[model samples]
Target: MKTSLKSAKRLFVALIFVALGSCSIAHSGDGHSLKVTASAYNSVKSQAHGNPSIGAWGDHLKPGMKVIAVSRDLIKMGLKHNTRVKIDGLPGTYLVKDKMGKRWSRKIDIYMGTDVKAARRWGKRTVIIRW
Candidate 1:
């Protein structure tokens, strides 16, 4: 009977672990995956720097865009550029993190914009940028 009880406890713990794993993987997706390459943020930086060729860049941000609000606090929490994360939308931020975040600059901001309501969705994130 003790062995059976132990097995049940182990099974319960395993089930909880699996549930939490699935929940993490099921991060918020504004009805789309919005696979944006790192180049997008790079473009923003260059454009902000008066890059003439920036005009030919992709369309500006729209609503429904998943906003990855990578802020100074995110850095404090260990977030870095090019770091991928699964986070829920808080109407102005995302819980992003990275491994090499401790050794990075603190003047860069990253945002994502999809063809959908990218701006609105992005607005829900902390990475605020004009479209």
Candidate 2:
């Protein structure tokens, strides 16, 4: 009876570990993750200074594109233009279509097309991202 009890306890512990591992994996997406501050912006704001390029990649900004702008530091951290990333707490995948200024670091800017109000509403927040 004691041997059976020990085996049951071992099984229970193993199950708990498996459950925890699954949760971590689910949260980390493909297992590559980073935490950074995120904000929202639109083309108008981005081009206010007469910059002609829609993005660093030269792609035109459009609604429903699911794209993101990463800081230069993030680009050095492997978030190159056109890389796909998944933002925690936000549904859907986002593509890295733009690059932020040199002064920014560990930050992401979500593109909201021409919706200035929506961009303003999003503001800024710390978010986890996975690639």
Candidate 3:
């Protein structure tokens, strides 16, 4: 009985691992995409997640802002590594830039649950800049 119980527990654990692994795989290569809400903006923190946003962090942003990248897989999209890229996360809209740097303004806003490390690695690398 003890051996059979242990076997069942191992099988259950294996199944859970497989399920979790599959989910992460599905999310792999897939990231939340944002848009350029304003038309012309001064500049931006290339990689950021939330609050006191990119705009508040800087000066000279406007509607119809020009953008620099499509996704975080920027290097894959031919973006030079460490180049300053920008995107707008409009509160209630979703916009994704196409490969050639054109905004396909969307009605839904995509939110990236970004972290400090991600922002630092991707956005402005200044040590004093807080998220």
Each candidate's TM vs. the true structure? 0.27, 0.73, 0.23
The best candidate by lDDT is: 2
Model 2, runs deviating above 4 Å: 1-29, 45-47, 51-53
The deviation in Å at residue 121 for candidate 2 is 0.8
Q: For candidate 2, lDDT tens digit of each residue in 23-71? A: 4223343657878999987878555445533788788878778999999
Per-residue lDDT for 13-110 in model 3, tens only? Answer: 99999987654111223332322222221223553333223432232323343323233343343333223332333222223332223233221122
lDDT of 1 by residue, 39-112 (tens): 12322443344542122222233333433334343344334443444432324433232111233322222344
Q: Is candidate 2 or candidate 3 better by TM-score?
A: 2
Give the residue spans of candidate 3 off by over 4 A: 25-131
Better of 1 and 3 by lDDT: 1
Candidate 2 colliding pairs: none
Q: What does the lDDT come to for candidate 3? A: 0.33
Q: Which candidate is the best by TM-score?
A: 2
